[model samples]
Target chain A: MTIVDPIIFNAFLNESKEAVESLEADLVKLESDLENKNLINSVFRSLHTIKGNASFLDLDNITTVAHEAETLLDEVRSGKRKINQTSIDLVYSVVDVLQEMLEDPEMAQAIKSVNVLKVEESKIEHIVSLVHELELLRYSMEKLPAQLEGERGDISEGLFNLELATSKASRITSELGAIVFGARLVPVNNVFRRFPRIVRELAKKLDKKIELKVLNGSAKLDKSIVEAIADPMTHLIRNAVDHGVESPENRQAKGKKQQGTITLNSFVDGNLVVIEIKDDGKGMDPDLILYQAAEKGIIFRGKENTMSDSEKLGLIFAPGFSTAEQVTDISGRGVGMDVVKSNINKLKGMVQIESTLGIGTTIQLRFPFSVVVASCLYVYIDEVCYAIPLSQMEESIHIAKGELFTQSPQRLKSGEEAMAVYSLQELLTGKFQIKQGIKELPAVRVRRKDGRLIALIVDEFSIMEEAVIHSVDSYISSIPGIQGGVIRRDGLVSIALSIDSLLETTFKKIPLAYAVNKERKHPEITDLQKLIEDAREITDGVLDFKLS
Target chain B: MRIYRRELFIFDIGGVPLALRMEDVEYILPASEITSVPKTAQFVLGLAAVRGKIMSVIDGGLRLRIQRQGTSYFVVCHVRGNTTAVLINRPLEAKNLSVKKIESSDVERILARHKLNPKMFSAAWEILKKKDSHWSETGRKFLEINTDQFVSDQMASKIIVG
Candidate 1:
């Protein structure tokens, strides 16, 4: 058979798969109401479409099975055959065969073989033998009734025990059903298995001896998350080999082993999957990154002087910013890092970089293991429900209304550290009015990724529960302080708050003094305000002093 | 000779009737709980889940320079591979309108009179003048908005407040 264009073929394959999935779901529903003509017609159409497409592509195996399935569905549609338990079983078997055909289309050629289809002669024989064995087991269980009669002869007790067992079995079956229908967990090795080959080839081409180690390869995560992270993870690994690991001669001169080591370590941390990539080679130079960013016009000239070392390191993620002296085919195109950042951000994940000038560089990528299910603490502000991810939450404290405005500077003191307090209502809806006659306000203390804590004052704290998180559109996700939307148990959509984004915005709004002296017991708020004005005047409002 | 009739989905936003090409509309849904997004343009009401997909909901009134008000329905429009919900005050009505193409001079006149950005509109459908009616002018037309361009403009105009 002539092969179709791969793009067209792939599209056909995806569409066919979706159709089959929908057909299966509809079939399950049809088991309850088999006389529903609409569903029967829908199922028939799906099979007919598949058969036609397969024939158009000249795939005889798939076309044959789909044709047979369509014929069987036609009988039911025409009311020639009544729907029954046996017919439902037969339809399920057809679905199984279709699923197998999807996996390997050539398998459809074995339709004539009873053992191959597993639904013909051999299947009946197997069922008959199982039934014979079950009869014997039932005969043995008949002694239990006699034993019960000899012991107490209480029929009510026996019935109660049976009822208890039935209830337990029902609960277990429901739990199993939930696990089967909910989000799937896939092994991390699905993405990691391709790395060793990549590292080997890149190391050979670069003429550097390198060792790649993968830890926790058996860790499983949601399939969608795993697929999303595959490309970004590959990009990070390539960067590790191309830009991070130095030449063997240079490594030796730097008092490092000739064979450099790159380790990919992943582990579950609470609700997050932390993947760390560490390379024992020449680390990055912060000053070089800053200079390169300036040269590329990614950052303003002289602005590099104001950036901290860590902030300078972050410039590598800027678009078209590269520290490499020359461009190569593998990397240094100044395109890969920004894409890595954006792709990870699309997964609602965060990436952080830590490096020592000469020791090594460790890049950490953190993602929520299951993007669908997350533990969220719901809080109500101005009668609006907002959910905060439990992973980012620190604790909730009730603050008296009088203490909120009684301090010289409006700040929340937790231990010896003071943080600038902001109202959640004001930040979200742009409404600054607190509820009238409210005495004690509930404040949620949230910690940023950088370990900075901020107290978000709200009206009250609601219940905490595990919820399925639904992501918002890209346009809305781009807005600061709004992460996504989560449908609560009450069927209402609540805004999932990104505490990190909120704190970043809050930190930017506060004066530099309060931000820098957050650890101090008391920083003169008046002096801080004056300093901010002076700094603003000197910079002519062109400079923004921010924490890295 | 063949006559061509263009079908449009017409709805009212802030009391002004507007029409959009039927092909661009995915489906109309009842406006539900919209999660308010911060640091966005005033026209962006927030995000809403429509048919299991989260879409950014834009207030059609604010986009057309009308007073801001709550909308009861959302018109889901798919443009440039992005799905967005345009808030409307009432149910959308599908009408097959027999329209004539407007001349360039008339287009310019309409643009100048409404003070509308030239890029925001793509085509104009001329409605035949009817006697003893609200629109009795000879050159009455309803401008067709370029949804792709309008969405991009709204997103670009978002104020990034810290």
Candidate 2:
């Protein structure tokens, strides 16, 4: 036996693991449509790559198992054997075994004694025939290129300028290379492909039928953002499967389809990529989440009575808050959703949940399409340049410094709405020294996601342009008022202000009465809070009775 | 057995000469435009772009409690995977020295006199000093800095103002 080089073996091991993951995803597709010849061929090629690599490394155990699986897929592809649910199950089992063998070398050794050699000696001829066909096809493909050259000879003298064409082609190739190198958008399917298998296993374990539909899986996003959100997306999916979906019998009694449908959809909305996970399961009750929040001490008692229904629903993201009545191995450990929220926040993204009782629930996560590229309005503060994302900028205006100080809390009137103005320099530097010569202050008016507006005082404003944002070191990122650092066209590292975090930190310092007066000015929000409180009280009584 | 010699790159910060391992210094470049970062330590001068990569530049004078002087050069060093440049007046030529000749007692005496942490300096040298384009026999004690220790200590004790 040839001893495999450790480095080559490790490389092959990593490649084989990825190949198996692709095979598992392909198998999921084949399970739904047995006659999907394309998917079958893809799975066959994946297994063939693994088997061939393993054989080259002289790993007999993996090579044998992968060859068996590949031969079975080839038989199905050639119509020698019919594809069915049983065949899909067999392939899934083979994939599971392959995964186990790759993860544990001891498992591979144990499987060596299982006598896989009894499967088929006749399949060798079939494999040889397939190889011969592939070689013949490759020969024809090679010949076609020569035939195309011969055809081009007839028109070459009169129509083609070879020198000009070569130069143009070279220029175009270089430009294309530059564009490809600069491109940062990766298909969301890179992350979405793992979920079909997850939903399948979770559905089976929970004894529920689930149909997962992924739309716009090809929508592109920043690779870092996609990787950052994968864990949170997994947590959300697991929670949806474990806590949201009911048993088949319960669904039947409720007059809904026995198989629950969960749709994962993505789309580009302006500068953001919006991903929504919607499930046709028992919807979340806002009041139940509020009660859970209260029970877990996440919120003060009676605080639930002052929140809007949406705010009450948002309580589900509070740490240590879970609506699960019993602890289960699947998800009820009570540590899922809050982590999802915090992870999203770390990516500077937002998660919003909307649910209608007995109807369904949709959780939407919106993130900037490209974290690196952002159009920002540059503002100068204390001789330093700061870039504010254009998405957060409402407008820029000049206000007199005297007018800002005349008001007790420093409010600015933009149209009819009164926005609180804060000195950007003072807030960021924490240096509240009085200026002697400044009369007019340039302020950038920005809006947060919650629809509150604030004017940031600055020295001056610069032209708006798209800038590449570079992540600051962790030590610098931990500081408030700074999101990340951005390299300007001039190669200066300017601070990228996190407008939402800055506004949040500023609002915390506002006095109690000013905040109340602002809330009172928006009476509609107050009324909605009251309405939700009443609804929560009634639903709390109903839930208590049901629990008893 | 081969005797190994350590290469040291000497530089001046706040009129005091300091030596660092030659391998630790990536490059010595003229001071470039630096962008100031808020809420970092006062010694953290700001960030400067070097070869398309941003590096945090620190004032070695302020860090060592020495009198501040305008920096004309930057000594870029990478420590523990983080690249930073220390502001310096000038960098001298590299020198090969016997690593085993340096005594720990000398390093301790220099640290004690400067009131610096003992971990900051790895080695000490008492050599003739050069000033005003002339080499003189004035005995000057130079401390070899532990770049990794200095960077890790600065990052750990970073103070962020609200």
Candidate 3:
């Protein structure tokens, strides 16, 4: 092993580890249907591959365990021995040893200590002989049924016609296609199952009376997408308990139930899967979030009053923005939500937060069915090509370059109230490189699900086509505005820009303060101020004290 | 004791002869159609697709701060399973040499002899600090490149600061 090339060893380790994990899963499934030939064959193949690779590498320990497991499975397959509970346990023991060896190969020399593999040869031979005798007896008994069927005569005349066969073949092919598609889909419960235990343990640890309710656990998503979302989902659940839910006494005083509830609901909406994590507790207060964002320099001071309630809620997803009064070991060093947002964006998903004061907060995440295939609108930014996922792009319009420089951009026909235009090249590279004296420019009017609209200026726009986007290395994907890259049919990779990341980063920066006249003209602010004053009078300055 | 003999793929970057252990070298191809990725470290030229894998091309001249002539080829090497391409002036030779592993304790002495700061060889220092046995071997004391450390160091120093 010391002589082995590290690269080859790593590749082998990865492949063998995956095979072993699948084998573990299949072995449990095999217990229910030990007689299923296809499943038994699959299990056999997994073990054989591991053994062969291990033997090639001269990994004596892994090879020995896998080979022993393979020999036992061969006995079951050959009908020399039956796959009873005892034999299944034997195979499981082998898998356990193999797993330990894979995690630390240096433990291989201790393989001699694995006493289960040293089963007595005479005991195994006796069981095989007993099973062989029973098989022979059963075969003799089954021959009587065949003799009875022989008297029924040939029924194959009209049953096997060309038309029927052709239709059956077509049906089988379609069924096979369905099976293949479904193979990539797994139930949402695969991830949801872990949450109940997590919530229970966390509730006990935090001394909070919180109940987690998971609805629609049977909803399905692509296996890859489901795996990708597991961490974010866990983070949200933790956040709900640690930060969202009020303590029991606090909840009682607030005229709520003593125990809080966190609900995880997943369902399919059109071509996308929607997963919502809703917590019934003290909701996210926009003003407090705004103050935190201001304090962190994520947003300019005094700009908090300018943003709407929903816009302030969006600030929680800004990097290093946390509303927790104190950092806890569990989830809130200010890095939680932004990471969740980025992971969701990497899945090409959208996140929407809806909260009411003292009511609750629900964070809704929507992901497309497949992360690999996407419909992207390809455009050229300074003659370099880039891709924007069509899910984020609402439309493309031809606008004068001067329009982009205006303080106020025209609203789109989609009826979004506020629209801002920015040069895509400037947003990406931090420098404007548009050629001198350019007049008309192509722009993409992109809107996130949360209803923030921005038009990005580009040199030219091209066709909107679905392309397979491959995720790049983290060194590149970790860049502020990049989601992944798409390998074009020409075998060149074009970067797929993340509209969510660009919007989020852009929104966090200081914006030019509104004109004095415009501030007075907006009625909403006056109404909100009046409401705040009314609340202040009713609460006798308590709200003022908290804000101060 | 058996002498560990390995092949070193020697190549030129900015007129300096450097060699990477041949086992890490995946391929060498003509440098063409390199797309520039914006907002990345200056050392990173861009991404190029070769055989369906996107490889980040690093400008060896910029990375090593060496003035170089025209880059003729991309020396593609694997760093922890990810392929990265480094521009080279030209192909030199593949030489088989006997390499002797230097202990971590001797690293400071070697750097002192070369009058190099530990920060200058920060990646090698990190490996030694971690007590990793896979040291950059001494084969005639010619600069033997550990592709993993070299590329990762470029990523850490250049990308993070930029």
Candidate 4:
């Protein structure tokens, strides 16, 4: 409703986690007392409650696995089958997958898809199969006829339970998925090893096997980032597998290997950690993309329809721009290429494609390893002061009143013909009341896009120490000009302002509030401003010199 | 529960000065100790380290826009519940003010002379306002600090932080 406030949601999620953990502990104890149907019922009830809570949160994937796990546990509780390892392990794996999926990459999509119900289906089947297998074995052992028996029936039942228990143990192991989740993981050389099994399974399903490879992984990505990159990487690889790699028959026909190959490589370079997904398959056809763009009305078909290949290729990032007519239900409609691009951008990274018609495609992605620390720049505009990241800043310059040229309502050109100036008032709405007699045009310019191309004009700029950033919940997340508020050195809160956003807010709203002598406001020493009148009177004879 | 206020420091503002309760002040450092934080609001002094942790030091005088005649000491006060710091000129003394009920009118009048918005003044300002003014509604002869606002929650309530 309100982006489901994370604080309360976090608390709720924590409670559910506790409930699941307690159930786990109880189930472990129940493992020994197979005939204790009462214990089985109690465990079933707890899992049922946890599943209900997850469903209420619309975490259906979790709900499904949990529901299935609960169903089989219900059978055990109903005395249809004795409690054993298979059932317990199924429940454990369900819980593990639920936890892992809670932080899964495909979660956002799954939340919207009907197939979200499918995640629990397999897990449920796994548990049911275990229960069914154990029941059959136990029933068969009991049916064993005469003499030769000895304690064979009992031993056979014990064997069935043990097999069931093995599965249960592994399911519990799957919960260790938590260990590799989101931010919790510290990947090593071995981390790359885990991907092959997944790739192989997926390849087998697609009826193709690619020699998947993992390159240098000496650098460890905080689990969350790794998780963040997972889906984007998956989409890219899937595209490479389906569209990039040719089938074995085709590959052989083309004088290439019958077994197509795709390589997944990752390493750290400069300030960025690079992840490149390359495949030796047919590359994307730029001409086809241009034709699709024209057909979709993304770009007008004009006399210049004979556009450069690069211009045509850029169409891949246009919204709703798709090259495929029928959705393959695979790596997007070639539609979400824009999404992949933008998502990587959100990570403060860039993605580029290097592909030729028959040659393989290489998608190179580079991201700032970790913005763990940022140099903050503090600026004051009228009464409101805010912080800017020095990481994005280039320089600050002072301008005289006459320096600003008003070309249009929302635009101010500062002698440099191209620079756009944003007034402080427009930056943060209702932040300060600019009235009579404030002097001096105090402004700072921050470099944007590239240092050479654009500059953002702001109220002021200077650098400060780095601190752990705490952002406000979404209720007040997008305050005009404010990116997030941070605790300052003096224990007073200073807002972290988005210079670009602030500028945009200014331009979008007024677009035409032309300034008159924009820089004439010099530092006015008023004897009576509400915030400082008392100190002024007491120090009537004192001289206040400015700090440089 | 006993609320231990941090160590207090004394400083002057104008010719008349006051002390800030130590619990509020995070650190006291030389003027030279302050570093420049770019693009910050004017009141911010810069960054400084107290004990081992680095913190932002604000110019309380600049924060309140308090004026003074000479070189001043920096008192970094932690904003309630937030890590932000507010810098103030040195406090003159640290004296505990007991809670008392008084008319808000008295505060308004007292602050009028200093050109302070009576809204921001402490109970101390109210007492001075009543004594200096002719208003009889200000009630009680002496002034009391709204303890909850002035100091800590262990005492009484009604002090507001905005």
Candidate 5:
């Protein structure tokens, strides 16, 4: 049957393909469970699915073979035949062949050619005959007990070609696809089982009894995203265990409960998945971070001595930004939180630190509920448009001509040597691919969290949502101005800006340390540099420098 | 179905006028205000606000050694996706002429009186002679003065005689 609506057809195709893939995995697993009669039920169910799907797709030849397999499985379920290795192999082969007919064109043709009739009547007749023999054999087998079975296969697995054998195979495959998405949570005591071990272990070392609490072990997430976050989550947990939980004797001396509490609360809020790690152990010291930043030359020597708490906290992400002196088996190197922040950012997520010295500390990271559908800021450079996720964006602003001034010296604080203002046209030429002459310039001011801003210049602008992002082949060098090229709706290739690349190039042009010393530097900076360059003329150059 | 080929265009850069392929330049907007940035080439003035968006302006005449007229006039052009508004001496009127060669195939050898530097063609020149191989008097005279070889050859012989 012809399907006009691609969405419904896609869903149907995906579901049936998933069912087919599981059928193969289950068929292989049935070899050891042959003596067990319940295993044969799943075998019957899988064959039944194959038969059903083949009919839906109007594949009469495959339906006939699948119906025969289902009949044999049904007979085995009745205990008329003895479950054996030879039987399993043959059933596996038929399943494999059925899958081939659905997935491969040559094989489908071969199956139809071998069968004289490829219709519902012929398929039904073949199944009825196989069932008769299996029923007779099932009657002679031993009796067994029956119990409920767990859902067999996860949807994320891509094992067999039972589903989606279209001409556009690449278009069908997905990275985040889940075959049988989890709708309900099953109770598992994973949260409680680990708390006792964690508390006991921390208490012995720090001389403080710590109470560990884990909440929402029953909540579920897509297996793929969960798989990606598991290790980083483990790191957060380990940080809590080694740093958040305090030892027992110190708790008693502080006139508090002998057990300190470490809480790991996970929950979902709309499209956001938040994992917060909080502790009641010795709190973080802002002074240490500021001191370390100063020592590493990240800040002025005396700046740490008077820095604000939040400013000190911001220094935690600075490179060589560790304050922990000793190297421990745990996360004592101070690189943990920085790496953690980087990892979370990779997922288009954010990590924040909140700590009160001697009180407690909390580290929170926020991830989107479903990353599949992302919100991106659409921009164009070199006549190609690109989508940059809004999650990674900081802010957008504009600087007027001449109003945009150098923050430190030669370059503007935004780190662009050419005034932060640029048009979409000039940015495209920098790509070095178009090989065309100069056009108009279009630039936008984008702010990054690190207090740095960049002016993104490009050729054109469009805010369209892109379904798929395909990178241009290496045969074509990526233009310096545009990030890469992707196909747009009208089949025209559009350039996508690589934000990171633009920022990097901008930073290279306008390093903050560089100061421009034009002949007339607003009368003040020139005087200041004059005092440093040649001292004699400075006294007269300063005409009532504003005290206000 | 009718197909259109993008033609070549030239616009005012600041006040200095320059010629370019129309395909290279995306679109043009009016020049209002430009932000001056440091550590750039002499021709690159700074960024500017064109339309509702900001743009980087370049002195195209200075960039290409073309003469400029005023600071108020500017032309926008794109190169490799980067947009730059070129400042020109004066705005040049655009011509949609169908030229025979695209700089590579249109070289002609004819008799001439004065040899001017071809590289300096952006400047004005006077013609002296035309091709005597198949020429009229006016055409011959025009070509003799205009051909670069004729002018260079005269200058060389004058130096030898002196």
Candidate 6:
């Protein structure tokens, strides 16, 4: 057989997987309505397609399984074999095998500790014996009395039926969702379970004693997010063993335990799923990082004393920045952290690092619970559409033009405190857009992680929509405020805004005038007018400087 | 690692001819609507959906500090490990030519005369086997663009903010 191009093989695999999922659902429905011609035809067509596609790729295992299933379905379709519990069960087993093959192509290890032929033969034998047992059970049930002696058993029938029906409906609903949208909530254990062996091997190789502890492994994330996050998690784990942890001798000398501990914890916080990797090793030295970062030109040399410990530790994420004095085979070539940060960013997430000089370091990655589909408020700025994730938005309010309590720094007085209001256009373009004679402007208020409120004034607000967000290329998402891209049903691509990034990059640089204006209130009309004029002058000067 | 001839995808920016490695060019498409991105360099025309993939559209003339005429096509190519579409007047053709690497010091005077920066180019390649006399008679030397440096945010900011 000719070697297949990996791209084509992957495409075929994805298509076949979806077909198999739909086929499984259809087969399940067919079991209840055995005489449903449409369901039978659909199942037959799916099996035929899978068989043909598998044969084309020379995936002989998949071809053999699918062909056998197709033959059985053909027998039922032709009335040669009657549809029964045994036949349905047989087909179910076949679907399971096909799904297994699709997931692990080439049968590398799908059937653990056995060759493909032996596994296939044994699987068939097991299925036949199971079918025999099922028939025996059915016969035994039929031989029982029609009515039970206990009154509780009579009531239990209704309750049992309800529970069974409810579970079946839920399963069908979930399977339909998987088939239609191709998004499922999968446990983080899918990615976490692969780390124990990796950590063990790496620690042995580095001549260190490290123990990895995974907590809350059942925390769920979108399937795609789990898959995309695997590499970054791997890199972080390796970095922990290579850089975060010290040698056993060094740990003993420091009055610490010889076995270092790396804890991987995951939990869902409201709408966000956060994963934290904490290592109890010789913790990161912020001063050392500061010195190295300045020497490498990653940060200003003299500004080290002014930065906090967390801020100093953030320099490790700068591209090509490393504090290691010597190169190692595992890491310190200075590429891992930045790549991890960027990968997390691409997943519409953020990475936060915290460390103590003597204690360990903790790196936390937070992501939206569901990255595939999100409720976003569609807003138009400069005639282009942008989607702001509703999770990040505190509230949307209409600000009457005349209701501004202060104009110097654009504040909207909510209740007790005034929130800084900025034009979304200005924040995005870095230029002041003067829109004259507008009655009321649409604004969205978002709170920072520090609980500071900032309102963004947009050109116009559209309806809140549940949009499907797709990650853009890193080149485009690398821009400060753009988190991802969403293509509308009408084929318009709208950039998704990352509120955190926008706050960090643009809103944080709103000048010292905001503080001054916030402290002093201009209650008189004359003072308000003068403040407005001053604000315009300052805005014009800033725009001039930016546009120059 | 050495080859006799390098394949180049030649295109026109502002009547000044330029070439990129043929492998770098993904495909060429007729000019389509490009959405302008805010808070980006002026040369970044913005994003465009090319066959369902988001690509950053770059204005070649603005990036290279040249005056380009009407654009006829957008050359979708890989720039700094990202898919980017560079606007050009036209894509001439792909040609294989024997090229000799010219030192930056040797081309400093020529590049300075043309108001071009040496850092914007990966290396200046003297076309040793020029089939057409137009470039030779005009004394126009072939230079390969360093996409990594040319499309960088810092480089764009410096060129525009200056």
Could you say which candidate leads in DockQ?
Answer: 2
For model 2, residues A276-297, the per-residue Cα lDDT tens digits are 8999889988888888788778
Residue lDDT tens for model 4, B13-103:
5543344555766555434344444335555455543332234455555534456556655554555442333444444554443223344
Global fold similarity of model 1 (TM-score): 0.50
The per-residue C-alpha lDDT of model 2 at residue A453 equals 64
**Residue-wise lDDT of candidate 3 within A1-548, one digit each (tens)?**
54565556665675676677566656655665777878778878989999998888888888888988899889888998888768876876787787778878453333323321122364356446545655654554444444445543333532333333333333333333333444566667667755765675577688889877776666567777777888999999999999888889999999999999999887544334689899998998888888878888999887776789999999999999888889998889989899999999988788899998788999998865533445799998867899887765787876542232223324222333544556687778765444444455567877755776666778788778755454555577667677666666444568878776677778754321111111123222333234333554453222211110
Task: In angstroms, give how far residue B58 of model 3 lies from its true place.
Answer: 0.9
lDDT of 3 by residue, B91-157 (tens): 7776575555444566666656544434423222111111265435333333456665545554554
Clashes of each: 0, 0, 0, 48, 96, 0
Off by over 4 Å in 5: A1-206, A218-220, A302-308, A371-548, B1-162
Off by over 4 Å in 2: A1-182, A186-238, A244-371, A400-415, A433-440, A511-548, B1-4, B68-71, B99-117, B126-141, B152-154, B157-162
> How do the residues A1-548 of candidate 5 rate in per-residue lDDT, one tens digit apiece?
43334443344344445555556545544654666656677667767776786577665787799898787777777777776877776786885676566566643333343312112353345445545634543442211111112133443322222222211121212211211122112112232233334344445554655655665444334444444565566566666656655556665676767667777765433234466678886777888877778878888886666777876887877756665556567655766666767777777667778888766778776664322222346665433445554443443333322232334434333433333333333333332222123222234555543554455544444574522222221112123433223333333333334454445445434221122211122222333333223423344442222111
Which has the better DockQ: candidate 2, or candidate 5? 2
Per-residue lDDT over B13-94 for candidate 5, one digit per residue giving the tens place of the 0 to 100 score: 3332234555555554334444433224455565553332234466554544445554455556653344446554443434
Using lDDT, rank the candidates from best to worst.
6, 2, 3, 1, 4, 5
Better of 4 and 6 by DockQ: 6
- The candidates' DockQ values read 0.15, 0.24, 0.12, 0.01, 0.01, 0.09
Q: What is the lDDT of residue A108 in candidate 1?
A: 28
Candidate 6 lDDT over A1-548, as tens digits, reads 34666656665665686677667657655765899989988989989989998899888888999999999989988999898878877887897798787777453333234311112354355446545655654564443333233333574664555444333333333323322342365667767766765676689799998877876666657777877999999988888899889899989898989989999987544335689999998778888988888888998777987999889989999999876667788778888899999999998888999988667889999885423455799998867899898877888877654445444434435444556667777777765544444556578878776787777888788878766555555545557777666655444467878777777776446521222213344343444334445555553344322211
lDDT of 3 at A169: 37
* Shift in Å, residue A270, candidate 3: 24
lDDT of 1 by residue, A1-548 (tens): 55556655655565576567557656755765878899889878888888888788887887998888788888888878887768766766776777677767442232322221112354355446545655654564555475456565576765555444433333333333324323365556666755665676688799988887775665556667766887888888888888889999999998888989889877544335677889987789999888878877888897876899889888888888877677878777878888888888777677899998778899888775423445789998766788887765788776543333214333545444544466676666555444544545577777665776667778779999865555465566555566667655333567777776666666555412222123232323354334334544553222323322
Computed on alpha carbons, the lDDT of every model, listed in order, comes to 0.66, 0.69, 0.67, 0.52, 0.46, 0.69
Residue A81 in candidate 2 has what lDDT?
95
How many Å off is the CA of A302 in candidate 5?
Answer: 5.2
Query: Which is the better candidate, 3 or 6, if ranked by lDDT?
Result: 6
